[model samples]
Target: MRRHTDERAHVLVLHGGQQHSTEPTSWRQLSVLRSRLFAAAVARAGRQDRIGVSFLRYAQRGWNDGAPLRDATWALARVREEHPGIPVGLLGYSMGGRTALHLAGEVDALVTAAAWVEQADLPAVHPPTSGRALLLHGTEDQMTSPEGTLRAAERLREQGAEVDVRTDLADTHGMMRHRADWHRLAGAHLVQTLRTSTCDAGGRGAD
Candidate 1:
């Protein structure tokens, strides 16, 4: 893992998973591979800036009633341990997005990509007290509920979150249809939210 010990800001990237499964995760999985690629793109896009990124791959494949959340908690703690009080961001997809929801309150900014949000999940979200959030989803996403994502965004907004929700027309849960757009939205969110344009890099990556 690379280290940007002087990083001014940080981003933790998380991949998606199923709602109910205990299967171990691997780099070969589509969701994990996609997020790894996405994290690299974010790092490259923010190359001129000072940002540290860590991509967290959960030990198991499913949400499994908060198993991924536990992993994310540890990852965030790791980031805090590494960077201390520097601004932090959370970027997650699907089930990982669900995990991010539980931890968003701890970061400076958050981006949920094609997240699998349910009405019941909103209560667990304690909006970033001094931060904000962005929710991205596809209109045609069959695997996750775009409406639910929007609803979650609304709830976040009502709770005083500076929320912005965008939709990809005719896209799906895979995020491959409009890959660059996802990159643009998610990457821009990190750079803008973290304000790392002038910050340093070679930040540690979560392996």
Candidate 2:
């Protein structure tokens, strides 16, 4: 695992899919992608000083029967070891989103794009969160239907979470990377909601 400091909130970006897409080479590529996206998003967010990003690489695993949760568990353990004082936020794309939700307890906030949902893991409402959960899905996503994210949102809300679900009909699964407007919109909303949630928690703690 490698760490990179930036300006917003300390983030742990988990990458989706294998390196070669066909070869599933351990989690080296996943870690690399995680770091890359973290750097890019932090730069775009213009909160480089407030955020620090890190990546956790693991052994190779298959998509259908992958050890994503196991890898995530290990990754969070490492995060705890290195930066116990920092609140962790997760940004995962596609398969990485699935892993993020599966390991949601470890993060203060979750920003998932084009997440693949499994019925077994589906919460009657959105997944419970101590902080917040943001689901970003493309209305025109051909790979994973927007319905999946909508359902997840429903479950998360039911679970007593402050949830936000946004749809970008014009953006494809990977389109958020190319579309600055979409990225800014999504990122801003996420930052605002996270701060709100954190402030609320602090207020309660003070009381």
Candidate 3:
């Protein structure tokens, strides 16, 4: 990871399930897409200098009976340790989106794409108290139910968190269609949310 000279909000991109592997690459193609989109969004907003991106590679790729949550937690801790006082965001896809939603309270902003939240025990999770969330789902997603994502979003909203749920009518679980729209919405949400947090913190900065 390249170290930045100045403090910047850090966004950690998490990938979905893959064939189990002991020697996985630190970053995957999906994660790369997410990171690039987020970076581009920030750049377009003229806030690229205030944000940094990273990836979390799992030791094994099956979601591991929720073990990925531990990995995600550790990654967030490391970000806090290395970039103390800066804001941090979590962006996950599919299984990774479930993990991001689970740990939403720990980060400054949360974004999930085609998240598998129905079976993730999301009803028991509390909404973030001081952060914003963006949940995206495909209406035609056969692998994961878009209804599940919408339900979760409603729950989060009822709990007093700022939540935005978007549905793509012409996409599937992979969200191959409307990829640009996903990136733009998510990236803009992250930047805007972090900016709000910064203002709330007296302009110190936010994740």
Candidate 4:
């Protein structure tokens, strides 16, 4: 993949499984939701024009099934290669959230919703204490229980990582689309998380 303009700090968005082919889709299935969330957060954080967002398309059969953790590392490596000095962040929803977790340490910060992290898939080495992570989930997420996020938070805390979690009070699965109210709440939370990390010694914004 070729590196694009370096005018803005980059965010690589990942989509959940909707097909099994290794081919690209005509339109990203989750672009709207991704853009809305990214836009809201960037605006709130006062970094609207300083940020760039792009999608990470991958091959998969279903949300839960994909190449093992080792294989998925290539994608993260590519992102790092594209922006050698720029800070990278990930915003993933649903199954895409799971992919973010596996690749968390590779980025400066991560914002995930309704994700699950299998122990075996975790990075061999945890991200340094400087790395930051945020997890959000719906209390009524029938597809992936709030427990999934809770469990991930627990593990991260145990490892002395900076991880924060927030759960929507009444939203169900696909909370990102439930209503404008949910979006507002989530958007605010995400903006704060990313903003806080931006000033950390290791959280330098892209140049």
Candidate 5:
């Protein structure tokens, strides 16, 4: 078996997007810029250079027919191929969160911020069978419903994964109202998950 030589942990970052469209995404998109902030903040919160951050630039701007999922799969394959058995995590916002949640079974850890979840989004809630998940949702999100995120969390628990759901009161869909807390919680979760589930990230181990 190939061993994990690098001590650094890898995180694949995914940004938010639209719905039912076919436009290609770009770095100039505000959605990508927001996710870029997430990546940078998470990296800084982590063990400095020990955390490898790669923000995925998707081919399209929407989740049309699971295009984002495909792009994420491709990106993950690259990460695994180059880094082999290193601890890998997924961090996403909104539509990107939806995409990461869809592929939770394949990574060591995952963080979903302001995840876009509707009734239709439940079918893709594949929690990490051998890892952990952190769901961060704002209590006052105007775009994605926090109730929907709660429902998704319920499914994640039912599937028998170690899941942590945190609510940021007064924050909105953009997750900027308490930006420092959001970054601290999410970045801490990802790095701590990479370390160990029983660590000080305030998460429990798998049952």
Candidate 6:
């Protein structure tokens, strides 16, 4: 699999669903939107010097019944192999959000927008413990259940994972109504978590 690489801390973004497509044009819009959001967040957090963004495209446009999760795991392995000790974050929208949550153990931080987590097979998957996660959902989302998102957050919390759930009353499943808020929150979380991890690693090494 091909990826965009740079010297700064890496942020891997996964876009929402599209019908399985062989053409690149089908995912162009979502890819652009996810990339811009990550860039905006990094800029807002003054992490332009610390963060580099990459958009991950799945072989299939659909979630593919857990295939995307496996793809994400492979991608994370690749990132860890190439970057070694560097910080890495995962951000996902809609179906991609569910995939990110599933693979949260592999990254330093996670940010999900309207994650379709209620439908995820939670019993078979383990919650994240190594990193923190931010879950953003709208109260009026028509496509996915907000209650479901909250429930997933609760489960993560129960599993001793650091999870923050934010609700936008005026937004929808797409969260376009208050896009800036999403960027600001996500960017801050990414920066904080990565920095915290670095500090913890340094402390351990000093011992």
TM-score of each: 0.90, 0.75, 0.83, 0.70, 0.88, 0.83
Question: What is the lDDT, from 0 to 100, of the residue 29 in candidate 2?
Answer: 59
Q: Write the per-residue lDDT of candidate 3 for residues 1-207, one digit (tens) a residue.
A: 224567457778777774244445455456445444544554454255466677777776676568778998999899998888777777788878888888887778888888877644676655653646888998888877788788878878878887888985579876767877887887788777766665666554343
Candidate 1's C-alpha runs over 4 A off are 196-207
Residue pairs whose backbone atoms clash in candidate 5: none
In terms of TM-score, the best-performing candidate is 1
Error of 4 at 135 (Å): 0.6
TM-score of 6: 0.83
Candidate 4 collision pairs: none
Judged by lDDT against the true structure, how good is candidate 5?
0.81
lDDT of 5 by residue, 1-207 (tens): 112235467788999999876888888888798889899887776655376788898988988878999999999999988876567889989999889888887887889999887788787787764457889998888888888778888888888877889875689888887888889988998887876632323244222
Which tens-of-lDDT digit does each residue in 116-167 have in candidate 6? Answer: 7754446533444344788888888887777777877877777777788898
- Candidate 6 least-lDDT 10 residues: 1-10
lDDT of 3: 0.72
- Please say which candidate is ahead in TM-score: 1 or 2: 1
lDDT of each: 0.81, 0.61, 0.72, 0.58, 0.81, 0.70
Candidate 3: residue pairs that collide: 87-206, 87-207, 88-207
